[model samples]
Target: MGAIESAAQAAAWLLAALTRELGLFAAIGLAVGGLDDLAVDGLWIGRSLWRRATVYRRHARMTMATLPPPEEPGAIAIFIGAWSESAVIGAMLRAALAGIRHGDYRIYVGTYPNDPETERAVLGVGDARIRRVGGVLPGPTTKAECLNRIWQSMLADERASGRRFKAIVLHDAEDVIHPHELDLYDRMIERFDLVQIPVLPLLANESRWAWTISATYADEFAESHQKSLVLREAVGAAVPSAGVGCAIQRAMMARIAEQGGGLPFSADSLTEDYELGLRVRAMGGRSAFIAMPVAPGKGLVAVRAHFPETIEAAVRQKTRWIIGIALAGWDRLRWDGGVTERWMRLRDRRAPIAALVLAVAYGALLLSIVCRIAGIRPDWPDALEPILTLTGALLVWRLAMRALFVTKAYGWREGLCAIPRVFIANIIEIAAAWRAVLHYVPGTTPIWDKTRHRFPERVGE
Candidate 1:
């Protein structure tokens, strides 16, 4: 009887301690979330108001003028790094070659010697503009390393052809290139050192209504590329590269190489793209993320690609990003910049803490349901009331912004569906953040956690 009583008391104590911890985590996590949401919301409103007050009249004039692209297109080279991208490389190259509106351009694909399938795929494209550069490193090296080899090839190509590429473009095998993509890059790189057009992740062949692994990507990216990056560009904050649909001016890269004493891209980092953008800003180079329509008619010129569609695939892909950008980034790219920079950095690095908060929140939720079933009452914290109120409003605003952006990128159907996709995104964040911690703690070797790519077979297909 004493043992039974002791067991009951211990169990009660355990529950009480867990409940207390949950409260603390909730308080801290919600505070972070609230700040992030507020920043995003503030940026959104500020940008809108600014555009209305000033840029609207200029935009009207630009639209009325119908600006023509440069008569003599600048020499630009597109580089795609393929590790095991045999399935989509050929189709991507073909689609890109067909879609390019510019004349003076070249495409260089970095392939591993062991990756004969991808090499053959590139060769099969049969276009003189496309050159395959096999690297000394074996298959599955970091994307940055592969890109370095491609850079060397680009240098050799420029020397041979006697035409210096004004800009170097980066892309992935799965990307659906816009016809006006290089045109914009050519035009923008003439002014800004780095140019990033919007990246719109295409919906995988999934149910339009079903909340899938890929929809989370679509929802998050829609909000990010449309608003967050736009705001970052506006506020003079460092704009991290989205890996694809981005270009860097050759001159800027040359200056960057001179500064770094070798290559501009970090060969050791998993997210070299993100690091490049930040490093460029740190060195006082000009960069821009263009979201406005540059394509003909009302179409917003953007890069389209399908993200990971399965839960396992999405988790793996996101794990790499979380590890690279937040976990590894924290240690390698020690904090810099002023107030806004610090704030943005905090938002970028908050994923691990957010993950803990999410786990505790879910656990607390389950505990509440169990307590109800068992006829027990939870001792709720009184201090949480106001915080909860503020966080709740932030969450509503966030959801509205997400839905609006998703609608703008996809359509009304997706925008409405993005409301529920929020929960799925949270799940992905939790799983990926924990995985990132695990990978970072052990100092795991970084390699290409390549996503299986699917190319759109036809235009708008």
Candidate 2:
């Protein structure tokens, strides 16, 4: 056939794929995804309005008070699992040691035998407060396994020092510890078994058009920590740890350890921090997620770090998250919780499916564009009118919610930028989700896909 005729044939195939796939399956997927997001939106909005009407109004909007440090602060163990983190570990340790206000704390850096560079970096810190623990396995093992070894090191140190840690804090090698976070954890762990502080992503120094990955992290964490997590705790759903800025009370860890065959952190899971919180809740432990301002000048008490700046790095990091939380978590945790818990779990598990929907939706758009460019109009069925309209409306609502949350975290600039970055975020997430779903087999173990990170120049003291 001639070139023009071949082009027409391809266009025809594209339209057929769009009509058959999108009309039959993607439409329903879109609607279901909309409803799932709507549920969270409803909870977030309702909780916000209620708190504004009651708690904030009653307290006169003065949450940042001159809080006292623990009179007798208990020892705290800080665990950081390092894999290929030689580039950032030393700087992170120095910043953390310098910034932390609490004196009764020890930092343990877990390093694999194969990763000598990271071990050397950790050793170079040479601070009496920092201890480097060799990993049980070689490099690039699952983070959960490394954390388990870190916990063991914490226990050994506890035995040697004759001082028990009141609580154990979790952190990453790239984290810039906030000055007030340890103090906050010190104060809060007294009341709750598990305490989680907000995690903020630091934007890169370079000005570039291709850095939407950083913005995606900023937007997601801002909304999640500010709204979703708070709402989840209010509704009695389990609070998943951000893997940084999280602390579990010593006694709570002991209890979870007792339950998990002497290992509080599961070696089988990719998202151990997430599972830790949920499993603790399952064992009837109290958890707190506090987002209030820590100091008079500083905003919330949060661990700040720069996320993966490039697309490949971002997708690899997010793929681990999706695999651990959505897929592996579902397989392990199963559906065992109250109404609120079940609802939240459903939202969490919906990620892979929603990602597929995103892929299909974008594919449909591309097909339509190609057809239009080829001067071929698609004769979509009239039955899809309502489905298309509702899906469009839901997409708008989702975007609006995302923008508002991003605005609350960053500023109006980022909020407006989030509108465009939404597409970029979805594309990245779809790629990650595909890998996550495809990587798992019935009895096979998942490989650790670690994301390399960098420390920003400035982290608040």
lDDT of 1 at 288: 94
The local distance difference test score of model 1 is 0.81
Which segments of candidate 1 are over 4 A away from where they belong? 61-65, 206-211, 294-297, 441-445
Off by over 4 Å in 2: 1-17, 20-24, 60-64, 68-72, 207-210, 373-379
Global lDDT scores for all candidate models: 0.81, 0.83
Error (Å) of candidate 1 at residue 442 is 7.8
Candidate 2 backbone collisions, by pair: none
Model 2 RMSD in Å is 2.7
Highest TM-score scorer: 1
Please report how far candidate 2 places residue 345 from its true position, in Å.
1.1
**Tens-digit lDDT track of model 1 for 2-73:** 999999877776776676567666766776787777867887788888898898767562321265665546
